[model samples]
Target: MSFASDNQSGASPAVLNALMQEFSRNGTSYGTDEATKRAEDKLRDVFDCDLVAYFVTSGTAANCLALSALGDPWGAVLCHHQAHLLRDESTAPEFLTNGMRLVPVAPFAARLDADAVAAQIAAMPDDRPHNIRPQVLSLAQSSENGQVYTPVEVRALCRVAHDAGLRVHMDGARFANAVAHLGCHPADISVRAGVDVLCLGATKNGAVAAEAVIFFDRTLAREFPERMKRSGHLLSKGRFLGTQFSAWLHDDHWLDLARHANEKAQALATALTSINGVRIAMPPEANEVFAVLPRQVCAQLGAAGIGFAEWYGDAILPDKIELEREILVRFVTSFASNETGVAAVTLAGGVLSR
Candidate 1:
């Protein structure tokens, strides 16, 4: 009944098998091996673009490097105030970009609308000599709030950023789930929608430590290899990542894993909606469900050994009267989630009501 995080899950069987197969053979190092080439080719086919793809160990590296490719030391990358770059990555983006700044935008949803994005860019004076030039816009698909953006929404955001003379980057930490939830081809949400770069996430889905930095505009990533190599992210045992990603992309393995996870989340959301005193914080999209559980409900779940994180907020009511306080538990279902696990969580929540 653990709704803590998808990261808590293990690698899928198929991904593990692929890694074992690679272990049986010797390969070149630093992304020059056969496995690496196959992974890159598979990503090009998946995104349906002649994009430059590089595999990295973690999502943070993918994001920082992708942004670094779009900016110089004095440039700025704009993203949602709660974006991983701003709130979670511990300043790696700034460091990787050689002191490039991350400017936070407002309107407060995990997802940023086109107008809010435009307003922030327009507010930054273009003529200031000392100001960090606005160079990139990074958005999270299936945003931090667990909301998924449709194809049109992604394109609209892209159009705004491009018009502002900024390249767009997507922190696709949940790329597989977003693709599966939208039931659209990967290209529709990325290259075709004007995204210049994307961090194609795999760790949070099913792979062990596989993540890819996909540059849809090849011209924008000319110096990325140097950036990656210099950062110590260029894995000498690179085929390990490649082996996992290849298995993830082959025969829609990634999508299949994502679909299963999303299905579990959807079922959990449906069950929660039926429970009294529990509020749905965000509609279920992809594999994450955010909820506002009553105080007693939260305590009950906690007592029962179900794990989750409190969603960020003041956690205090405006008035002297203490309201429910709205605990935001992040319920993440992975490909490994089974019917029994889902049902167990549902029953636990039901205990709060009784």
Candidate 2:
């Protein structure tokens, strides 16, 4: 059983089949192919709006391109301190934005707190280039901690960001899972919630590796195609990227995959709560469950060939968990997670059986 990451899973059967079908069809290159067109149409249908979208192979490229499209080089992108764009992307956002600063703001309830963001935006010294004006406000759906943001929460942050002349960007790395959990239309928390651009991810849900940089405010995408081409994200035979999304989104297969993962995570969280030495840290709003596991249980799970991500830091973790003897672990369930796997891990712990 592996909970290392959602990326550990293989592509969904539908996505694989779509790719196989595309193998025989000869199409134009660089997102001009039939598969590419099909994927774009699927997104428009999913979000229920006309928009511009570009397919890429990684979320990094999607975020970088989408953010760069909204801000100038001297501007700043405000995002949660623990956001993937801030901590995990390894300067890609900076390099692509040409040194556009990713200013970290405190996140409350697993999202960019509207008050904190507004205060930061106002606190900036905007006296004629003395300091960079914050131009973008970025928040992650199914946040890094695996908590989902509600539509009302999204609307508040968006309103605050927009009032201060800031464009909103959502790092939807687990977009499908968030929507599946919220039981809301994709547009309800995104475009309709005032997000200017979205880095919609499919790879972590069920695709092999495909992401979309979607501009709900189509005007922000004016120079994005040229930027994407220069950044090497514009795949030559882009049909491969397109085929993944085309099949993953068809018939709402993406939501189906996400629901399975979220169910497994919720079940695991419930089981872990009964264990003697485990404490549900973040209480999982999506497919990721963060819990404090006793050091002995950690060893037991590892010995049984079960793997997990040992998350560091006590930023959001409470004082109830003893950091000295317990480790903060992230248990991530994906489309591939099954009941058998969850049982083996939850029951395998010697510490739990006590």
The estimated TM-scores of all candidates read 0.95, 0.96
The number of the candidate with the highest TM-score is 2
> Tens-digit lDDT track for model 2 on 223-336?
777998888887899999988998999999999999999999999888777677777887688999998889888887788888898985644665566778988889899999
- List candidate 1 segments past 4 Å from native: 314-325
RMSD of candidates 1 onward, in order:
2.4, 1.5
Off-target runs (Cα >4 Å) in candidate 2 are: 107-110, 318-320
Which stretch of 10 consecutive residues in model 1 shows the poorest summed lDDT?
A: 314-323
Per-model lDDT: 0.85, 0.88
Could you tell me how far off, in angstroms, the CA of residue 69 lies in candidate 2 after the best superposition? 0.5
